[model samples]
Target: MINTRPRLAWHRARLLTIGVAVWAAAAALLTPVAASAAVDNPAPTPLVSFTFDDGMQNALTQAAPTLKKYGLTGTSYVNTSCVGMTTVPNTCRASTDVPYMTWDQITQLQNTYGWEIGSHTVNHLCLVSVGDDCQATKLTAAQVDAELANSKATLAAHGFNATAFAPPYGDYDMSVLAQIAKYYSSMRGFADTGNNPWPLGDYLIRNIPVQERTTPVATLKARVDEAITNKTWAVFTFHDIRPSPSQNPDDYQYGTAELDQLAAYVQSKVAAGQIKNVNISKGLVNGSPNLLANPTFNNGIGDGWRTDAPSTITADIGNTGSFPDSARSVKMVSGSAAGHLFSPKVPVTAGTNYLFKSFLNVAAISSGEVGFYVDEYNAAGQWISGQFRKRENTRWVESMNFTYTPSSTSVASASLQVYVTGTGITAYLDNVQMLALAAGSTPPASVNLVTNGAFDAGISSGWTTDSASTIQADGANRGSPANPVNSVKLTATTATRHLFSPQVAVTPGTYKIASYLNITARTSGEMGFYIDEYNAAGQWISGQWKLGVSAAGVTNVDLTYSPSTSSVAKASLQVIVQGNSGLQAYFDDVRWTKS
Candidate 1:
């Protein structure tokens, strides 16, 4: 095993360095008064601080590059005793997880990237009194004193100006706080699902854990959006900056793509001035003015945007069908195959989240795609990462709204690229937007497999069902978020009841069956959906599969089945219900998607 990565070794340091609080709080932990949102202070806008806990080397190799590239900084709380040691010699912590950062790298972050250095206890002691980790038995007061003092001392001795302390494991109490406050300006913790509304007190700084596998990009964006809307600060805690390694990947580890995607969005949002990006100290500041030079496309294309070479495409400042107030937009025509229009470099914050949108009207014959692209770069001015995309409609499509994300942390700038397979195709682009994403609607499902899937025809037109069932198109309670107006309800008592669909055309391939089942009530046996295949001879060729639902409130009915046999002539879908008396079920959005 390559033990080179930092293991957050503090958990193993134990009571060896109980050195008392002699680091002098006034000299080491006094936060600069210049930063916004001091204790109990309010700011005009919300602030979000990006912070990494533990001394992983990836913090430098992986995270710092993006952070520095985006003109952003972060705070990494590390255990001093394990400093520079790939794996600490002795401690309760696992050997594989004890790779602490070298003092050299720590200094590099502070001196080079404006990153804040913070303490996380001498060696991740369980704060004796809180008594959570490191052993069932709590450490003595003397031991706790030694851990805190020695930890801060190590950072101070190594030329690191650490102003905050993150209590290891997010565990702390009034007893721990009283002690920590004497040696630190603030102590960061991971206790809240939401952002912390400041002035954050000296103790209990809240942080959301952006674990790789558990938290999604959409989820992080929502948190940042919440901070922006509520005027609160969002502080984050991370462990391994890189993705889960092939060997012994823990929940604390996430893929670089996830981090990069998040960082790219943060940088974009920061550039837009939609939210304030800060290090640990400045994390509670008022927001800044929008950083965009020509957000509304009012200055004309030449004013700010950088277009492709003139030979391949033609472009001009256009006003036809423009958005309100902004009487102008950029119009482009491809003489050959493809063309691109780009924006000036937009500085971004690393490890952040954002949403983007654009209003466009495309016209004339088209064959290729027209979407946005991001040119990514690192702080050292090296191109690093990016993403490109186009809306589905490029042929005679107009007055359309395009929504997307930069999709990479290294995304340094965005561009509008139009590709037309057909020569002489024209596209109208306007009001390119880089905005925050609010809690949006759930995405619609894919094309369904079964026809008359919803029975919106007011009746089960081509469907076959036992005479006991009926389609309830009336506004009775049979409704789901997906299909609110139509459903086929079945009430069964003793005898089994089934609703089958007419035989549909089939080919040798895989198909997905998805439906929603809502049980008004159930003493359940079972109600399910099924797929059956028959050969050309009109006889069952032994291809059958089923998925069932047993509970209430709209249970998901989804499964994948394949009639791989070329002999398949046709296929039929059915819903069968059986069980005790008085079992009522409503099913809707019955779809069979072919892949």
Candidate 2:
């Protein structure tokens, strides 16, 4: 067994290891490969979660109805002390003028619309002062504990099981996280500004804030696209939904029209089986604890971890690397003697499936292999059996994920062991996660609604040009590097040229339009992109000019648009170049898809 040490000593060692140069070199060679592997392995399904904060009245009146119309649900984080208040309390971080939801109304969100109710502390006290409205004073340890425990208790009193928490102003530190872990299963933060990766950091769940004017419908749909492509989870944070929201971001309010558009876009993706729209709790898998303490190596070795042949293992190896959620990883410098790192034994059920995952950066492997195994223990704490889950032999950097189930019903607990054998093999491991694999359905294939989007055949294949311009296939001016094909080149003189795409059949839902353009030569005016709407009789009903660009370089433009009227049955993409004279441009990779 490996020896344990105090956390203070481990922190000092971690600080000492920060100056090591080898870790930086290994990370440089390993980070990109790890990122590429994450994109390549699409096993984790994409998820989108809509979460509202402060329990504002509009959450029930506006957000819930819009979400329900699309068969989607959301999570509402409420401040228990401010419920039904006409004015916000000074202790709370919410707007002073906005009204909060009544307890009964909050119940409707849970029982009627199927939304999850989470905690936002009792008085919305900031755990750490970070220069925000909630940061008037820093709370003591006792105050923090009371805020977490009492809010959860209050929710339970109202028949709500609040497992997730969002701190006021997203203010928190390691101390706050410790207290949060004691009371909540997950913590959603403000301004985290990206999608959450799979095997999510339950306590540090990140979110993208949606504010009025700043957050466009296109931006929200693009986030959904990112989740789909990366196979990650996207949590959108909203504070208030109003009929006429103030444009100031400080107000933290969003318009109902834009909210409806975003909801419709999410529904389209759900309908196409590209993403699953879930509440906060439903999005989390199993809610199981990561049995390995100090899994990320943030506290260095000898903290809930031990190794045979300590000379071969280096803790707190990397400080600046693509280590997920943390800046450190453990390094193994192996020789002919095999070195083994062991995790603390954690209780496990006999028939349950467990997912063991770790990000590995193998800088060099000359003669041996790195293996991950699960060692099973009996009820009497004796080693019973072991299973070799996965091994890496070549120079590689990727996430190693394997599912292990105990062979016998007598297996009581298990410990994860990573062993490196052979000569001259050096590897770094980080973010080791072991939890039960949640049950889920397989994702369906995604479809693109536009055809001949790359202009592969010719300009006339699936495109039309108006009388003001002459369109020809240009092999020299392509916009997309991936396509690498002929693009439609429009030449016009002092007149607006219209290049129309094939009409795509439409429904009363939001759609995303994308195209790449390069204004090779221009004299006076800019190029415009529009979505033309047509009624069932093929008559033009409405058209929205989305964007216009005049720069003499490659420009990628994409926007989300919903039909103005229900009578519209078809829509077409229009690319127009209006200039004085001698105008030339290339357009390629036009895409219109149900968002």
Candidate 3:
């Protein structure tokens, strides 16, 4: 291993000295109060932060130039300890070289080209699983501490202000977050982009992880458009660069053309002033405005009709459709802005199906279309190809459905919009919903995946639970805000029974199954997961399960299972938290990924 530590440390120290000077310079150049004000919802489209992981050298050679050409900006999370190490020998399957982005290269990208730097830990272990035992196996607390402090110090030394981190392998639990919050202001976690308005309210931000290098640019755009429509802040996590002279090829690295296409899209958005391209940390600093907190609309609902944006209008409730109580509809009350509504700009993964629906007053105009779109960006915001969904006839009972997919997964953001292009067809919409369909696995047998679920007497639009399941608000918080630990335990019992599966659309493929569980006891109770094979006739062929040892804590389990040879097009994931312990268990983040 080439020990670049001494050189890296020295360079880092020098760079930090200079960075402080530059930040001081930049600070001096700007009116300090102006900078502060800019953070408070400055004019300009909101920026979508794009981040790449693993700090592979290709980031410099392949990803950076594309970003620079387009004037887009981004952050690359580096594993500092791997700075001077040689490419892990013969073991690398995709490229012959080891995958660490060198300290020296990182400096050039930051100082010369202006790329933001972030920490991926000292040695990139699954930070979430790193307890004392795990730390003892590889690096120590001192080492991990060094990784955290030193990487920040190193970036500062390299003239870059790194204020963010994307946990190694994008894995981190509460304990992992506790350890990280001590060092970084914000961290990135994995997210599903199928639905937008990115998961909010946390130092831990969710991101879309790009694993396929083969995805096309157009497809990438469609996905991005959808994300924006859902008003989601999209983040992309990556590793490896394309066609490198290295051994690790299968790792999620993008080809040069693909990387360029992605970057260009972001740059186009920036050039148009649709968004201000900035690093991930900056996005963290300018967190999305809590629309509800602002004194703009009543009871905290802006409804995409902004005072700042002209073509949009908020109207009084009128009779036309269904759902009578719905009020405050958007009307073409006047001007060129007559049919316009609000939308987002972030992008999403291509080929994914998304469902969008809204509650509207029955009196509003009978029908119209909701528009969904996305804009892809590079390090600089730029335009790349994307997709959109146009829903035609609106139903009085509810909102219309508009769904689409981009040709690329590399888009930066998307937009969800509604317009009354037709005359005299005004609509009143509320309780809008955007749901990302689960991909990667077929559903298991014997479990009816619930849609728009009700559990513990509370409801979420896209969740699943037994409609027949009875809820008992054991305490005063039956539906009260306090003591919200209500129970609606599944009543089904058989040789084996399962509950809780969300709307999952699956094609035939091998998949990896996983879910998050909150166990109430540390006993033999296990959450049994299954992969069922149900034919068109609703007949079950076979399925498999892995009994996870349940404990009274939030634990995410990755199940070991595969699909049967026969084509099982439609399936549901089955979960049964069964055991004599009689402890309550809650589930979240159920995932089925095509391997």
- On TM-score, the candidate that comes out on top is 2
Q: What is the lDDT of residue 365 in candidate 1?
A: 39
Instruction: Please provide, for model 3 over 1-595, each residue's C-alpha lDDT reduced to its tens digit, 9 standing for 90 to 100.
Output: 1111111000000000000010111111111111112232222124466677767777887778877777766688877666655566523222345565567888887877777888877666655455532443544445555666777777677666666777665555543444454466566775423322322323456666665544556765555554445444556666766754223334565566766777777667656655455577655323222211112222222433332224444543442212212223443322322244443233344444333444332233322233233223332334443323333333233234343343455643333444443233544444344444323111211121334221333334343433334212122211101112432343223223345444354556555554434454434545555555565565555555445454454343445444565555555555554535455554433334454
**CA lDDT of every candidate:** 0.56, 0.70, 0.45
RMSD of each: 24.3, 19.6, 22.1
Per-residue lDDT of 251 in model 1? 42
Off by over 4 Å in 3: 1-36, 40-46, 86-96, 99-101, 129-146, 191-199, 243-249, 272-276, 285-595
Ranking by TM-score: 2, 3, 1
Relative to the unseen true structure, what is the C-alpha lDDT of residue 65 in candidate 3, on a scale of 0 to 100? 80
Residue runs of model 2 more than 4 Å from their true location after superposition: 1-43, 87-92, 130-132, 287-353, 357-414, 418-595
Candidate 2 lDDT, tens digit per residue, 1-595?
0011110000000000001111111111101011111121224779999999998888998999999999999999999998878555533457667788889999999999999999999988778784547666678988998998899999999999998899988888755665565567678989567998765656667889999978888999999999999889999999989999998887888999999999999899999999999888777654235556777787777555777668888785444223234367788887545677777666666545666767666668765567776777677666666655556667765557666666578877777778777567888777787665322222221234677776766666557776433767777635343343567887765555677777788998888666656667877667766777788888777777666676675555557878878888987777666646566877776656675
Q: What TM-score fits each model?
A: 0.40, 0.49, 0.41
Better of 1 and 2 by lDDT: 2
Candidate 2's error at 423, in angstroms?
26
Number of the candidate with higher TM-score, 2 or 3: 2
